[model samples]
Target: MEQGLALLLALSLGLLQPGHGQPLHVEPPEPEVAMAVGASLQFTCSLACAGGAARVRWRGLDIGLGAVLSEAGSSVLSVHNASLSATGTRVCEGSCGDRRFQRTVKLLVYAFPDQLAVSPATLVPGRNQEVACTAHSVSPTDTLSFSLLLGNRELEGVQALGREEKEEDLQETEDLLFRVTQRWLLPPLGTPAPPTLHCQATMRLPGLELSHRRALPVLHSQTSLERPDPTSSEPPTTTSPQATPQQGSTGTPRTDSSTRTCRPEIHWSLEPVSWELLCEAACGPGMTVHWTLAPGGLAAYKRREAGAQAWLSLPPDGSRTEGFFQCRLDPGGQVVSLYVPIQKVIPKT
Candidate 1:
């Protein structure tokens, strides 16, 4: 009992402080932190006791491209745009009252694209057009997968484009960036079909699952053509073989030059209180725009502009909602959609 009382007295007298090899009570107490490339990173190291004023310094940040701010009893290390090369161990040292302490943090970094890029959002019926989808940069290739979907059918996307690398991005890291791509020959669009194509990217982090999806409008392009007979006046064209594609089986569908030129784009903006997602798709004269959620639920408040452009306005809760905000255009056959994925992350220790 006397020994316990003596220890209490020592603590009350401020005679004890963090010693060498001990932690300095860092703000982000997690043993490690995982951040996306170009993300903002900040952490603090602090020490306080009766052993004079505390001073802290950070080590192992030469490649981090960050700055350190030291205060009376604390120090903060902040990196505005974290580089992939900066991922590694970071150390913080604190000293006070002739006593010194140290702590270490592990930083994990990843590269994931914001959008699931799809090519040829719209297409003419009858042409065997090659469709492709791509994700720009990805690291830790084994943890990521891409699925190309047509209606309910799913196909795996290949890393056909291979790796796009830089000398400085990896330095001595085991994970490197890669460009994933896949292509397919558009199949014949049977009548009354939902011929939509989707490119979905899925990433499995330590304890988080991230997904991004983009869809293409119905672009069926398979048809047969035959010369019209001028010799017989009694409807010679009706005797030809019936066309079965969306453009009809009798002949090739006439395609508009404007439809081929129109591009699909999604402009996303996040503000303090609310966020917006705008889709600029080319819907020609026969197509119309529709908005819905992928899992079959009420979508965010939306408005369509100029018959081809659509906007989705989320609630003013200042929190990002997770799911796919879809914008689609068709003549009402339930086809072609562009997905805007809003992610919500609950970091795991």
Candidate 2:
């Protein structure tokens, strides 16, 4: 009986011995709750097993747009563009022989921000314009904080416009509206203009960090100056003409046409057969006007004065509508003119 007892103890000890310097495998970490829209979730799993070969498998069940970000010695599962329906069980399984480990993360997907846009107000120097920055998402209020970012500078805006709130009627049945706005002022126009303005919104939810940004080109008007003190009796000591400043360069002349040729533009309507507006597009110093057309969505196409080509094209919809038309000037009249509103109706259903 003593020998039998001793043998049993030896077998138990051998079986319980440490894994002899073998690598330790681990299950991936999973989120505790649901993920919000516009947020991302990543699951990491690793295999540290002794010897020749071990494998790790990661999968997210029923989550659309789910991806295997990495699959090697370690594995990662990531989900982007998540929606409410994206929530489900995520599983990470690691296996080596009879040794196995697994982890499960329950995911609940919430609504993401819907509309994102910049205010259409004209930004003037030293004037303030409220940029309407907002996000419509069903995620918990406390889980996300919208932010404004430009380059290395982070602006919550001049002042917090505060989140939009809706009030329900006593009957609890009525339409609801919510909006958030922030004000930003353009710096005084000068040489070497300031950087373009942009707004960004960031969504911080458990297991996810997602952000979106949009840029607005800073527009400024140039002021013209008369040749300094023309009335001065001074023979006008010869002064070199200042170099023409390029776009985004600080305070420079708006129009520099010293050597450029001035082409008389012909703006006429072909459908109505009448001249609506006469405008000239400066073509380099010697370049002449070649062709002009009422670009897409323009109501009428007009031929230029100097027998230049004239044509008109319909917008996406086949409706004869009157609206702004783009005029392409020439060598590559690269700088296209603004939309010229034309007066003509092709017809609409």
Candidate 3:
């Protein structure tokens, strides 16, 4: 009777713990993640213990739109041309014999740039100069904007030059062009030194960020001071001719600095052959004046190399012609006279 009672107690224990008699299975699916902006992505799920009749189920945490790639024993997902919204986690569940097993993985998406550029690289100072930002292979679906960065201030007035989109069989590319003309009044010639101008082009794409830049330099014309008569020894006091008289002994003192005479001297012949025979006052005695042939085939002074004396050489083309010639005078190393124009000199009749 005691043995019978013990056997009844053992059967009661087996009925109370049904799973303890067999192996327990738990399925936790591994999560898969990938980037979406520029490339494709894939997810893989692994299984632990396998049951003869086990089944796998796949799902996403926050992914808005996606289809299940495979739902058999194992899970595999492929995403083409992914985007930022595809970031999140995935879960897989396996079920068999009234037991549930699951696995999870985190997903991360990357954003691909549609346009790129540098900071302001060009500055335009004048009213007509142009500033430009150049970008290559930008996304055509995105809008591009451009502006100027002056110190800490942002300026607008830029114009889009052009846009282009092309697909090369497998991939597509785009370009953007922006330009602006300087219209503000340029500072006076003596205004504080102008600053460098800078420009930027920005692309407005939903999932991308990029920009380009250019800097240009400002420029202006400079005012020049009037020069005194070269023939007169004294520097010009003013631009007026009355201030520097061309007559009278004191009209314009011929300083001993230059070889030029304040008064006009005898008009020397300007003919090529005459120049060869006449002696130039500016050249050293015995120095040869080398004549250079210009494209017009005219005999001209190439340069006056310091030598014993100045001499003239006829052009090789025999096209040595005459119009006007400038001559100066020098006494030793000091200039005794200034340059003066000699009119035409033809062959003597």
Candidate 4:
């Protein structure tokens, strides 16, 4: 009983001493901080104590380790080339007399996607073309979106692929890369005015939203041809064809000046004509009618003989045929036209 009373008296005396037992309060850095990769950051720990000497220290929650950043009354932690491994909760501890106190703050490090790009700088009109857009070096892969647009209109049936994750072992971080593709079937002449293609990328995250856009111009060629009048009464002049060597003839074949020439007439008509008979009469030896497109113009052709069951479709590679030719072209949506013409060449008399 005497020993127990002596211990109680000693504790009371210690408590009565001035500034022997004081409360310590610590204030950590901001509640949260965000920084990009390869950047620098600093965290501060503030302390308040009623008595006794006060000391401050910092520790990482993820690593469960403490390190001395500053030795004065306050503590400061500095990080360089901040990366994913540096992100987490950090604790600041302060001690005064026999009392200890701590506070915690969170750090977040992220990277935004790089700029967007378009493939095939130039786009040709009236052809099936593909445009590809790409973005690189993005973080937090899931918060990204990509799209293609023309002016304010969003293109339909576009193909998009992304989120190819890359790991960096040294930085202990992950990055993402993405791409989007669009297939366009341009009209023969495109729009009345040139169109612009736009590529966009968006990143959505808490407390932050980022977006980027890139534009490309579409180019096209235009052409027009004037049709000749067929009702004139004047006869065309005759020019002799180049003569080939004959077995018994010593001199080249010659044409008489009085011989009259019949020229092939071209016109745009709405009604279909007999192609087989027209071709047979117009395309004889040394006398033929040729078909061609105007400068900078593109067209597709379909043909039907006098007695054919179906119209034969011709490839886009400029083909020549003597027949009733039906040419079609598209300049833009809701605009299309067909030209049907027969070339008639008169045989040499």
**Residue lDDT tens for model 3, 160-210:** 444433332324322222222222222222235345444555655434456
lDDT of 2 by residue, 198-222 (tens): 5665666666667655554343432
**Alpha carbon lDDT of residue 10, candidate 4?**
53
Clashing pairs in 1: 125-221, 126-221, 126-222, 217-336, 243-249, 243-250, 244-249
All candidates: TM-score: 0.43, 0.37, 0.29, 0.42
Higher-scoring candidate on TM-score, 1 or 3: 1
Winning candidate number (lDDT): 1
Q: Per-residue alpha-carbon lDDT of model 1 for 1-349, expressed as tens digits? A: 9999986776566454334445488867787777888799788888785747777877776424447877877888886777677777878877777556678888777788674556553433443555666665676566677666665567433234432333225455454677666666665544554545566778887546787777655523321111211111121111112222121112222233764533334456554444565655554575555554332233434454556566666434434433234444455322223333344423222
- TM-score-wise, the better of 3 and 4 is 4
Query: Order of all candidates by TM-score, from best down to worst?
Result: 1, 4, 2, 3
RMSDs, each prediction?
20.0, 15.6, 22.3, 20.2
Candidate 1 — what's its lDDT? 0.55
lDDT (0-100) at residue 125 of candidate 4? 53
- Model 1 alpha-carbon miss at residue 301, Å: 43
RMSD of 3: 22.3
Off by over 4 Å in 1: 1-23, 63-66, 96-100, 118-133, 140-142, 148-177, 182-197, 206-208, 216-349
Give lDDT tens digits, candidate 4, residues 55-174.
Answer: 777778433333346675688777677765677777777766655566666777666645555543334455555555545565655666767776667766444443334443334444
What lDDT is reached at residue 61 by model 4? 42
Best-fitting candidate, scored by TM-score: 1
